[model samples]
Target: MDLHYEVLGQGKPIVMIHGGGADSRDWPYLAPLLAKHYKVITFDSRGCGQSPSQTEAANYIMDVLNLLNHLSIEKTVIIGHSIGGQIATEFALSYPQYLQELVLVAPALAGFVHSLDLLESFQAIQSAAPDVSKMTELVVNSPFCSVIKDSTHSKLMRVMTEHNIRKMFEWAAFGAVWPKPPAIERLHEISTRTLFIRGTRDHEDSVKIETHFRAVPNIQFVAVAGGDHMLNLTHPEELYMNIVTFLGEPNKQA
Candidate 1:
């Protein structure tokens, strides 16, 4: 599927991918900071924001590659959040030639066994299908909001939640159809410079996934103090600084 994307500035390219229930807008506070040093691209993944709904699951990886191909970006830095981070990991594994560097913010890895409570929460949300108001409420109260200390950031998240609730539910329902192999064992295969960032207060599953990458030689992990799953929104400055520093390193580029 052709994605809705925006390209800004010039120099080494940086592609930003948002997590589930979000779109390109998630980078408004950070993209510009990075754009000052490199060309930056942000887009709505398939079935989110302005992008069209998708029938097939796990097509996000390809959709991102296709977007790069469409823009003639052969090699660039890739930054992904949550599920977007999962796609970036898959992309690095599948097409290492196209990456310059990788930054995963609270990325969700494939094959990491989720806790029963987490699974149950998801099932509960799924079972409450078509209840947009309830879903919106649940999302607003989710761990995604834990680190949103700023009122402005809180409002922004709420707005995004309202806008994407229906589509979020739709995407969640398609999850059962796209089971992927575990990526933990393949981390060593990724030679690209990769940085993993997670919040101190983020979900347990997200925090725990970092442990699996401890043995991966090319990965660097950092924890944001007092941050949450929505660190990009709640702590954009710190996130932006870490990204700029990582990408700016002379020897880090692939």
Candidate 2:
């Protein structure tokens, strides 16, 4: 599959992966800021945006590995959001040697059975297939609300709430379907440094997942106050600075 990808800047590589439902366009605003420090690459995952998936079940980790191999990037810092975070986590577990660091933003690391409520909401929206306006209304007015202010909420919803493909949406729900990684059980197996960022008021599952990673031997978790699930959009400056600081931190002594 020919996945659509964009690269910016030049230096150590950083691959930015977007959450489910939304595509790589989710990174346009934030990727440029990160590019100032390192090479930044963002792309639509298969089945979303410009990339189309031929198989009913898309294995995103393979696509990610292929993308990196195609670019000849031997090592990278993977910065991923939501479902992309899941892909990144599994990638780190399966190929820890290829990653310098793993940075997750409001990741969906909690188990699929645990995230059933989120799944159900997504399913409800998929079943309804609401247009942009209606989906925007639901995003702005729902209890699952996380975006900070009306203006920011409107802006993000405007950008993300457009796709209404039910099959793809269900595919995302299933894509999100996985038992929590044994990474939780074998966090020490990962030698790469890891960073977990979450909104203080993000969904309950996110908070729990962040807490779980806190015990990972080489990981740190930072909570952004007054931020929501989509902290990159709601509080980009805060998120950006935290990432910079983490990336700049000294390596652990052997």
- What is the TM-score of candidate 1? 0.90
The lDDT, on a scale of 0 to 1, for candidate 1 is 0.79
Candidate of highest TM-score: 1
TM-score of every model versus the real structure: 0.90, 0.84
Q: lDDT of all the models against the reference? A: 0.79, 0.73
Q: What is the alpha-carbon lDDT of model 2 when measured against the actual structure?
A: 0.73
Candidate 2 lDDT, tens digit per residue, 106-144?
A: 887634345677777766665665454565555555444
Question: Local error of candidate 1 at 110, Å?
Answer: 0.3
- Among all candidates shown, the one with the greatest lDDT: 1
Query: Least accurate stretch of 10 residues (summed lDDT) in model 1?
Result: 172-181
